[model samples]
Target: MTAHIEQAPLVRRVFWRLAPTRLFADLISKSWMESVIPFVLFVGIFTYLYIANPAFGTIGNLQSISASFSEFAFPAIAVGLTLISGGIDLSVGAIFALVDFAVLFMIGVWGLPTWLAILLAIALGGVIGAINGFLIGFMKTRPVLTTLVALIIYRSIFNLITLNYSEELAVIYIEDPTWNFIATGRILGAPVSAATLVIFAVVAHVILRNTKLGWRVAAVGSSKKAARHAGINYPLVLFLTYCGAGMVTALGAIFYAARLGSVAGPTGQGLEIQALSAVVVGGISLAGGRGTVARAVLGAAIVFLIQNGLTNIGLPGYFTAGILGFVVILAVGADIRWEKNKGKAIEKTLVNPIVFSFASTPDTSPGSQSPLALNDRLKDAEGLAVGLIEGPEDVVVDRLGRIYTGERQGRIIRFSPPYFNEREVFARIGGRPLGLVFDKDENLIVCVAGMGLFQVDQQGKVEKLTDRTTRNWLSILDNSRLRMADDLDIAPDGKIYFSDATDRFDLHDWTYDSLEGRGNGRLCVYDPATKKTRTISHGLNFANGICLAHDGRSVFVAETWAARVRRYWLEGPKKGKLEVFLDNLAGVPDNINRASDGTYWMAFAGMRSPMYDISMRHPGVRLRMLKQLPRDEWLFPSMNHGCLVKFDESGRILESYWDKKAEKHPMLTSMREHKGYLYLGGLENNRIGRIQLPDADQNWTAHDSYWGKS
Candidate 1:
């Protein structure tokens, strides 16, 4: 008891000493600090300014500084939208200039009404946006390239219409009173332009935060492939988003025209840098699929402050570009550095509790049996796999009806049904086996958590095929190499579909995986012919199970963290489409199977627990873990109880079953219903169990291990 008393205060002191300020000081001492990178150059600028002149901090100057958000606010908004959607827009400056000149021509030379000219200019923005969207969205062109074209096109046109024409001296005058009010008038002591910018932000926030459109837009940005599976129209949503962005740029162009009282090549010129800087510095990720409008505003304000402050303090004009460039690089660098530092903090938070739990006699063993019993109708589940895998997640059958299972240590054991007795080590691919599927030509595909993809032949030979897709296009942050490749399915042509469950954290760090929406989970595909791996989608909380459609036209993926199923269309007008197949799931989906009856059997790896729900609802738990714990021992929800649910191709819940006590099993990972019997596999279990199903096919026998047996 005295020992406990002494240790408690020691623990308390240790915790207290790790507080923010102290750690920050320690962080600075590390030779590197995240905040230092971006602020390095900016800090120098601010210091030079303050030291050079004390009045720079005055309220009047600050207000004037903030007021200038008007010029580049719209461009920031554009970049933010693309960033949130998980892409970049490099052509914003050229587009802004183009829109500015078009409005000038329409109103001054065409003699159109100011409102009409603005409308036409905005329409032109949309037109330019449509071009960008079509190239990137439909053609699947790289964003940098497509936008580069738009950028060049718009800039060239701006030059031809304004610079070249002005040399001959073209005239387009701005004379509309309402347009002038919008550009110059003040309301509530703030620039009407600023107010308008706020309104733009609010509208964007609503779309991104309040509605399904926002979710879809974000989904597309995170993973175009995953979004397609979720039934999200990639092109349509992205096209619409880009078009809207174009409209926003047009608004900026109008503000420029109104502010300058004319349209010229220089209008809206060289502003993309500021806009991109604002969005990025505000914390919009360069990789996409995660950002907020409020952040955009914050970013814009900072950019405006810097630009205004530097000019006011007598900095050279050339320094503005250099300063902006430095800030942009710093922002990205700082974000990464911050996250790295943040990861260490999170590790502490996550691990300390678990450590404390251990110190307090943590239950390292499997959890106790559930008190509640389930009245389940899914009695037999054997019809799904027909005995491919037998022991806890033992066997996984591919398209060729071949069964592959893992043994005590690392050997991949293959089995067949007719004899159904002698299971031999077909492959020696290491790591514990989790899920499996078949490609078009009957090649076996396996998901080995720490190991990644494995393959086998007809003669019981094994090969370590791939740990991840090798392509220059993806950036997985260290977590990209399939920490836990739980389950997989194949598309019609031969694309290997799988999930990378926790990119920031690995399989063992599953708890921290749930805490932060770090977006490490990803849906990826490997092309056998091309051997190229691409992250079709990312930002998933924890993507798990997978199963392709019988029609060979659509693929379904399970996001365990999101508690939902999503479908991706492989062909037709809706190709590259994604939609939520099911939502608010009762449990985290594990492995999925397509039943003979045309429905899909989704294995609920664990039932819903209020504890898990609460934890998920508050992301701070994860953030705190990031702030405190190490990578491994963070607090996370346990997936101990098992449940199986039936869903049709349309994602409608057909029926469900559960084993609450975990008596027959603990932590069920996959369930295959074959021949009136259900065979189950658990991630951490000793045996496979069977139950008789009332309506399953009687003759549905296990597949012969003819393929993947080399």
Candidate 2:
């Protein structure tokens, strides 16, 4: 057990070395990467200051920074909360000033106790905020406009009251020991307000991340219409969000008033602008939705540190504001660009190009003499259910000659034949159904991408079989469920084997899987008898097709991106062993189906190209090309030209068939022989193809070969 545990990480290391996307996918996936640049800048600034000034890294200076940060941190959190709720509160600074003046006036002018005055002042802030909330939420006023108007009105009212009582308030001297201690007390060598700010930030972060209220706020901010459709009460949420921001601003005002021992018009002047700049610089999107309280605090800290450091360095006060403004613009621009081009950025930074050399082949030359040469054999083939089907990627015929195929609309359709004239909706599987087969009871089992394994009963009702396999714990990305479950083939003892092709990319983006060349794919099995699914082997490169061997002792799997086929033993002495069946193929393989003569029919979904092969040798070139070029111009698999090949159980290529022009059938994904006719299907083609197999078995059916004749 110990030996096995130790080997797991080693296996993963080897897997990632062979397939490099594992190195950078997780780094780019998280929202936190946005914080990295600012954090680096913070570190660089701090290091420079500490080296240049001996007093900068001292405990006294650290304490000063912490104390100053507490003043802005709470207000920044207030603004961040409102921003995340898809609204703005520009009156926060006005609210802060009003609260400070109200508390001092009540205590000094009216002889009220400090505690009562503080409570009333805080309540007054909420009341004022509620007025703004009502205007915006209930009265349908725009948030920015309503708040801007509120700021002007509140500031005028504050000035009018303070100006009237200025003479009487100037002579009063109020002092409270408890207020002083609360304002300046120390905990663990840090200021009480600073410690309290940390506690509040942590609590706010938890509430935003782990609560229904936070989810609602995020939904509203992300898209108001979508949030309403999802049944969130937008007006109520907005109202409560503004009310909460008002409460936070009140707390900050109280702290500021106590620390300074005085209140003035300039007490909270320019605070709203500074806090807003901090929010954007800290990685909170001003456009709305995604942000955290931690982000708010980080932004506040950055702002506080930069301001303090500039002051210590004897820089002019105006330079501090100018630098912050520049920072905000740069941060916002960087964020917008990153959001717009993240996918291409990920491909460029993470996916490694496959370095490969395609040696000269006569088959690829002007005049090919190999038996696997391309010709017009497929052009002469006839189309079946031409207008009724679209993109029948895999086609299988039941005993009664009913053709079943998966379509683009996440449904499996059945065409009944003598001539396949009747088209019927079989089942709505709710996923892109790919590889398919039948169980012993004639239930059609399917592999649905983004979903899991499923089966369609005789009544045409679809049932979920198993969507989860044993998670590859060593995998860099989460692999708890089958992602791109592409193909499957059933074993005799009620076990179904399937291929999960690239957990990182979806079926529609299979080209990305090829571009990545990462061994992020796996093979899994579902046992009907046990009602369980498990991984058999993993770390395969784009596992696409699965075919159970004729003797029922092994299964053949095609690693499409790697151009290889592998065999995994299911029974006999070699049980649980895996070995390569075929390698260095002429094209990228897709699906493999059993043939009556004990051979196999494999489809080349795409042929190899010289340019693509050359480009694979330079990962940097591939990555830059992916980012710089349009989707249609990127170097990708030559999917326009493909062919079908017949091979024996020993992995020998028997013969190849092709459509040289590739007009009728550009990409064949799967092919199966039924009686004397070979049925073909393409992933993007609009029709099912049928061609005569002259010397093939006339009475062979996959159903009979597995379950015996009825």
Candidate 3:
């Protein structure tokens, strides 16, 4: 037992320790520390400072430190936003200086009201930002070069103002209570600067995560081309993000200059570097559209701490520079480390395979697992007498051990077992039939790509249950479950549960569906008694497969586009909540069926290329791909290599089976085990393949075949 336990992970660990594969694996695995790392660093470094210098821990000193952090924090956040859009705003520093001067000049020199000056400062910043956006977005200038040039131009104008216009600045008073409050005063116990931080944090957080802007910004960053194809205005998204960043930075500068009571030559200068550093520290990549505002703030806090710590300890400028360099190198290293170790990281998230083995028992193993580098094809069936099935999308079985398959020409056909003989069309539908499940009443419940839910009775009579339950746009738009009804399974309560894979695109346009990468598929329950379908869960990604748990307390649904499997608990502490049962699956799971041994069998509509799987982890990469490439050349979920995977109710993967090419199983979308044989169906193939399951019941074909049989 000990030896077997030790041997279990030997291959996996060896594979992971191999640097190339390990690095690829890590990059794809998500890090919870992504959000928590900054906090840990904040506490750790600050605690050390407090212990080293007593004054640093004092409330008054802390207030000043927090104030200091917020001023830079705002500009850094702006930089973070632009960076996420795959650009940089070198003018963030210049804009801040101008806003400071503008506010002072507008209010102090021109006799404008406080509110008016603030508004003008904000408006001017937005306009200038629009100029930056126009250059980068419309002119097609490179982000770094364009922003760098703007930085220089703005600096020249700023210096000219200082050199020639000090006389105009003379009219401004050195102090005003209102401006002072913005910079230094408090409301109740909270510092005003702290309040600014909180406000920006909240607003930025919502825009980047909860709003359309957030998604659009991410889309542009990932791939402008793909975003446009998905109907997103690429340039507009970039322009608006830049505009918003400019406004936020300008406001922050208002507070900064207000605190100082003047706009001087040194005001708002060289701050962009600090902001960039902070954003990188917070995990926002220079590559774009991946990090958050909170991360940028965290990066800003780290910078503030570093500056303060080095100054107090009297470190040399060179050493301080070295520390900043070291920090950058370290963050990048960490990010790279994470990216490369993705598969290893995913392997860690799964329950131990030993525990997984317990779910399948001694006779069973997972069937959808990837095979060993496909050295050769199966030899025994190399010369068998067999009839080929043409373009079979899904395969089902009746109680007498006969196989039923949904074919390409909108028909379901049946084939006798052994040498897999003569096929005959069982029923006809309007379009392709993808998922097939034999229900309690011996009706084959199916998902028809264009037609919706359907059933085939014994004599091949077709019955449409409910397919257009969801509006096409509201179905699977954005590669989510817009409207393409693909697959289904029956619930124990006799309800027909199915997947509307996408409302956005049809079966042939599956690639477009993947590029959108938005949640769209929905899970619906069709009550046969009333012939009504109600959406049970909305916002799934290409909802490809459905299976109710053996106990019927929960259901497992596959979100193929997201490479995720989620469990919806009907009765538990976590009822009605969808939780990630499995994520970053090695394959795109297509359908789920009950196995004879009290487990489920899932077909991999596609297998994941390690490179592609890792790319999903980087929002910037995907968005960027969308922006640059035409739809066809872009990345897609690879269904060419397909498999049959088995899992228990608790999501323990038992084992897997694989066919490396379309020649064997091509996009195997569904599978059902019947009477000692596991039958496979392919969405794009012209044949149904059969594998003998040694211990499976040989008496049963599909339960539907036993209709009226004694």
> Could you tell me every candidate's TM-score relative to the true structure?
0.48, 0.77, 0.58
The digit string of per-residue lDDT tens for model 3 on 189-231 reads 5679888789869887888888888988987887888888999
Candidate that scores best on lDDT: 2
TM-score for model 1? 0.48
The RMSD of every model to the true structure, in order and in angstroms, is 17.3, 6.8, 12.8
Candidate maximizing TM-score = 2
Question: Higher lDDT: candidate 1 or 3?
Answer: 3
Q: Compared with the true structure, what per-residue lDDT tens digits does model 2 show for residues 539-612? A: 89999899999998999999887777899998899899989888767788999998888889999998877676
The full ranking of all candidates by TM-score, starting with the best, is: 2, 3, 1
Report the C-alpha lDDT of model 1 over 1-710, residue by residue, as the tens digit.
00121133455434543435433433543322423433444556667677878898666665455445665788788878987887778788988888777777667667788878888889988888888888788888898878877787778877776755673334444567887787668777777777788787888888788799999988998898999999999998878888888888888778777777665556556676678888888777777787777677667767776777778777887897687778778789967676558756543543222111101211112333321225433333223223434444645554334446675466776655644455656777767677765554556677887888777665655666668753323441234466777778766566688887765455555665555434457788878788777777776657888777777687788877666788877888888878777776666777888665667778777665555455444444545756666755544445666777778866667666666455555567777656666666776665555567768776554232212223
